[model samples]
Target: MWLWITGIICFIVAVRVIYNRRSGVCTSKKLLDGKTAIVTGSSAGIGKETASDLARRGARVILACRNVQKAQKVADDITGTTGNGQIFVKQLDTSDLASVRKFAKEIIDTEKELHILVNNAGIVAPSVKTLTSDGLELTMATNHFGHFLLTNMLLDLLKKSAPSGVVNVSSDGHFFGKNLVVDDLNYEKRPYPSTFACFGQTKLPNVLFTVELAERMEGTGVTTNSLHSGAVNTEIFFKTNKITDYMFGFLFKLMAKDEALGAQTTIHLAVSEDVENISGEYFADCKIAKRSEQAKDRGLAKKLWEMSEMAVSLTQEDHHYAGK
Candidate 1:
């Protein structure tokens, strides 16, 4: 009888967990009537949901994605549901340096006011080591370096809009890396044991970039913050091995937050008045959270910044903002 009672209690607990995984909490419906926002990887998952939420608040949202067709469809859906037709789709493949340059150039040439920038696009580490066209590791190129370049290229516009915000979608997996090998960012010297470790390595730079960028933009009024959106049930884990993917799917179904919930912290940082003056902070569950020691290393942050400039070939002339 005791065993039977215990079994029933466990079953009830399991059901509650699954329910929460399916239904996420609603974010505050603060209006952003005239703001122009860019959300990379906005075609699906947290990116898509975040974009939708922003549109609902009357923001003109640009769904920057690699696949124009899918992005167009997402834009149409958001328009249909929200009755906000200000959504536009643009091509942006963050893994490629050329593509990043093209996208930034187009935005800079076209847009008048740039208010919110969400670097929400990312990929899980490849099962095997792969190199991008720019001769950098694929995961590092897509997750960190590409966004690094894009953000820097648009820094002037963000500053001009003053009080603008940049939201970086980092992950809790950053703690998995033992230490960042600044010299071997491409993982040529030290072989990664698994793609998970490689993924973690890239996330560290996201936080470090936020730290250093916030410092530079201190008086510029452009706040930059990073967040761990929680273990979300998204399509990122689908590209791995069948067995591994299935296991992750099962676990996520039982424990992961829905995409909407995962996007709260990102939306919080982007449009929340509470964090209007806040910068260089990491967030989780819509609150400021502590990051790993390596993430907070000021010296390492500066080193990474220099290395990123070298990787992207950013010159002094590229920096239009004198102080930044």
Candidate 2:
């Protein structure tokens, strides 16, 4: 009987933590009045919440989404709620080079300075080896390379904004993907672990991108950071869990926070005045956490940057990917 009581008490405590939430250590105050933000994948999940938060704080949010109808709906919702600001929906398919170029040209043509670039758009499908029309792995191409190209294309506007920032929404997935057999980057030669490795390899690229971009952006005042949004109950895995969707169960609930909790870290990195000067840091649960040794490897970071640039068709000839 005593053991049963103790178990119930522990269960209650765990539930509180899993659903735990706060306004963050940094003030929830609006300090982003004059900022302009571009948030990719703003139709749902953390991205949507982050856009809303930024909008409420007085930032003009450009919703870069792949689905035109969904983007319009999200824009309508945000516009209705945050009347003090505007939400511009821009169609962007990060996997398609043509789409990426079109979006970049849109920003370029508009001549509006982008102060915040949230690389929040990403896809995590099952173990199948898929490739973009550009012939790049689906995960790496969308998650890292797409953001890389977008940043490079918008580099001038960001620089003009002066005190700009870039937030890469990474995963707590690098530890499981060290020294990934590059020869089989597509996981075709040997069957890779379906769920884990598929996402893990792309996450590794995120860390390297952060490190290399930070080094190159030393004097740009354009702080860059990646984050592991602490396991959240977002739609990121809705496609993978048919049983969960069917049953509407909460088995992973104890380990999952809601989308709001996940968006907290992203908002912090994007607009908080506390870390205005802080850059090249990895965050977890809204706090700076130590990263894996692989994340700190400058050499690895540089190599990954070079390969990614090539994959995305972005090079120094345009915007000096490597700081001169």
Candidate 3:
């Protein structure tokens, strides 16, 4: 009886693995031969896998990461394995506004075309309340605001390369926030119960940003969407205590999808012709997934867009392109 039970368990596990592998597959036939793609935080995890996938498909992929040395190593590995020398590394710290500006300027000045922008870099949550140099919550700043500024800065180029795409890697955790506090996004007024709740608040803005951006870029032929990459086994959860981290990591190894599998939706959004016309939608497992009602609030989305513009301090010229 024990032997039969063990065999049954093994069969179930094998079937589950096979099913997951078959689902969420990206069937993009479009070759990005002359196109350029930017994947922020591509030094490791889902970002690295996503960048490598794009490079394999003939796109001039740029690995935008905070750690130049690490990114360079990943770039080299990607080039060697994919035989796509077009992969290059660029320094970008999304939490810092100055760094974001410099990175965007360099890309705009150097790259002639920008077809895909994958805002994949994100942080879970700091154990304590951490503030960036910009005076905003670190998780919120990096996860949403940085990508917000970067996307607006490159809007013109994206328009020039019409039918382009902007893929924001959001999470189902956005539902944890319940509602967005547009007035106090920095947690000055109300305190968060835990770090996870704070992180969830930041993710809410990602979907909101995607909805508003797609609305603004309506006729420009640029599609913007957000996605939940599923529970991925990545380094983002290392901020906890060692014992807790170890336990969580072990569970993730058993339950979470690998980085390559987690990157399928992102890759699909980036290069799939099927979604070429789809915009302002939330996706999971490479399908149009439902989002929390808060994520679907148009008024909330617009309000957040305005607040984000203010937080980023967009210049008059930048506002022109941002439709402010």
Best by lDDT: 3
lDDT for 36 in candidate 2 is 91
TM-score of each: 0.92, 0.89, 0.93
For model 3, where is the 10-residue window of minimal lDDT? 315-324
Range of the 10 consecutive residues with the lowest summed lDDT in candidate 2: 244-253
Q: lDDT per residue, candidate 1, 1-324, as tens digits? A: 999999987885786487565443445667999999999999999999999999999999999999999999999999999999999999999999999999999999999989999999999887788899999999999999999999999998898998799999999888875489877898789885486788889999999999999998888889999998887888778766757766886677556787888788888888888888999999888888878999989999999988888988886755754443
Q: Candidate 2's C-alpha lDDT?
A: 0.78
Residues 1-324 of candidate 2: C-alpha lDDT, one tens digit per residue: 999999987985677574565323335575677789999999999899999999988888999999979888988999899885478999998878778888988898895788999999887745567778988777777887788888888878888887999999988887766775544555567765665666777787787788888888888878899988766667766655445342322443445667777789898888777778888889876778777888888888877776666677775544744454
* Tens digit per residue, CA lDDT, model 3, 9-100: 78757855875675586877778899999999999999999999999989999999999999999999999999999999999999999999
Q: What is the C-alpha RMSD of each candidate to the true structure, in Å?
A: 2.9, 3.1, 2.4
lDDT of 3 at 305: 91
Distance (Å) between predicted and true CA of 250, model 3? 2.1
* Ten contiguous residues minimizing lDDT sum, candidate 1: 19-28
The list of candidate 1 runs beyond 4 A from truth reads: 1-27, 320-324
